[model samples]
Target: MPDIVNHTFENMSTAQPHYDVIIAGAGPVGLFLACELALERCAVLVLEQAADPDSPLKRMPFGLRGLSAPSIGALHRRGLLDALDLHQRMKNPFVGPSSPGAKRPAGHFAGLVFHHEDIDMSQWPDQPDGLPASLLSEMAELETVLARRACELGVTIRRGAAIAGFDQEPDRVTVHAGDETFVGGWLVGCDGARSIVRKAGGFDFAGTEPEFTGYTFSAELSGAAALKPGRNVTARGMYLQSQPGFIVLQAFDGGAFHDAGLPVTREHLQDVLRRISGSDVTIETLHLATTWTDRARQATAYRNGRVLLAGDAAHIHSPLGGQGLNLGLGDALNLGWKLAATVQGRASEGLLDTYQAERHPLGARVLDWSRAQVALMRPDPGARALRAIVGDLMATRDGATYVAGRVWGLGTAAVRIA
Candidate 1:
């Protein structure tokens, strides 16, 4: 990338460094965007709310993330693909049911598996051998690697601070975070679902209501033997024990529990688990746990004057099929170059507008994908029948190929340059 540019924030009042771009959130998306802008010699500053980037939730089973075709291609093109070693070591979690000798399936949709033999690789002949259609990664690993790259390219990351508020001028944007103030030519928000920038920037988020509250965690279970292995579709809900203590529960509660923002205690977890699993399973020790709903929403516009939105700040959906992380990464990749060009005075008249025009449709499609899964996962007779039909179709070559293509983001066109 570009040479390191010296930036100091020792005393905000003494010397406040100016930047071409100021990004909110130090997650993978924000960090990746920083690296992209710095690659073109644009001074960048990243403001993160958390004091420490390290978290247990960002590692292992809890933080497991999937890299789609576009994400892999983007990293490879930037010469950062070799820096990732986790995918080579970690096993693919998308692989379906196993037998004594069965060809491991490539992926799934709503627990319906699709085999490798069924997918027609000829359909995606444009895929190069060097870049796989999809790979496995961890959130912690991705953020660490991307952060390292961003720092190398002269991006300043300010942790323990966030975009509390900002003012947009005709020439630049002035951001206020805690007691510090920073100035930048343009501001991009990559902060998560409840983005302060998106809210303060007056972006309208529109989407559908959730059908269920999903839980993911690792806990000690007293009646572990009662719970069946693999994904079990019960009349109450769906439960999956991917590993010994790692469990995934989908309770059809109309997303009430998750929306209430109640604490995820062991007693509540056991109650939900018992109800969903139809087993008398009790969580002995709640190690790690988090709750999410299939609530899907997208911002009406990605950019507002000098302020922009990317990653989860732009859109959000259920973590089903692991589309959330990939979608955010795709957003950062799509916006970084265009925003840099605009800042550098090399962009065309409508270059920045294309960011939303092209990406919005894709984001909507992903939201619909999550909604469809929620439909199939419903604990109703109609949904059960539909799930059966869908499962049967997924076993077919054509069906498997189509679903796999979408899941892995195959056949996605490259960004057009002005």
Candidate 2:
């Protein structure tokens, strides 16, 4: 049971509707979980606070790889590729000893594993399945696609219905949404950082201080005729360079970043771009700007009794290596089927508990590396030495390849649910 907050405006005493499973958010993680459950013919209800597509920041919008290479194998196991409409958002895999694309390009230090430059896609473990049978990326579009799939599978998506309260018993939960109520045999909180379900469910999210925080404005750079030569300055952000926080002047085709405090003044951005590119460049940022603070963290528990957490609810970490949303989606995908089975009653209730033991350690590793990488990003002297050591290590054949494997997303493995 949770501390009840009574309200007058939204009808506090409506009879709650019953559902096999009720998810408190309609974000990508929640929607994806809904789709996964609907596949098993589990009745699901997704409650989203906002109305329509303008449903707040339901999913992070960036052209980020959906999941790193290792987890993609897990996706394959779940038949996610076959189920979702993810055809274009795929990356070239680079893991283990040999990757055809690992060779450095001539002249520029773009491909060198040292400095972690030019992010090698080849360092991730090879999928037993060849060439993405179905590849998808970019979370903004992902949300829309997954929602449609869940609907097709008969999952009911309720919009503008914020969770006002919930009552949880050992076997079921009754949810309060403005004017409506829902009962569920199980609940999965794939909600965002400020999760009401998490709060109502009495889950404690223990987090270390945001060891580091940075601001970013992902620029929609329209390539200037004068800026053509500076395109080679594709190294990710101000890391390995002497700068306060990271300033990544990337060719977006449309790209995104989570750094804030980067002076959005075109002159400031252009100046930073010129400094990094070593060339006079002219670039214009399209009107959209994003300001956010990223912290390295993971939740102490992935579950709280019948209520479970996934995605940002379970962990919030630095956006380095573009792992935030990827990891969240993986969390949704990992917990979805088990929840589906548990709700359907084919599996024992204990199945859901495994989510914590499996995912917590993996997230801890992510948190540690997120801190280490951000530490490497800081312009301070200690970080400088650490970067130097990293550079030196990458300079060696074994060290470079070894570190490259980790940096490229091969190091993390999935929390095996079975």
The lDDT leader among the candidates is 1
Estimate TM-scores for all models: 0.95, 0.71
RMSD in Å for candidate 1, one decimal?
2.9
Q: What lDDT tens digits, residue by residue, belong to model 1 across residues 210-290?
A: 888888888888889888766777899988887778888899999999999999999998998898888898889998889
Each candidate's number of clashing pairs is 0, 17
**Model 2, span 164-280: residue lDDT tens:** 878889878888776666889878787788788877777777655543323233444443333322112233334122112223333221123333344456665666566545555
Cα-based lDDT at residue 370, candidate 2: 66
Question: Which sections of candidate 2 miss by over 4 Å?
Answer: 1-17, 54-63, 74-126, 132-136, 211-213, 218-286, 395-397, 400-418
Q: Candidate 2 has what TM-score?
A: 0.71
What lDDT would candidate 1 get against the real structure?
0.84
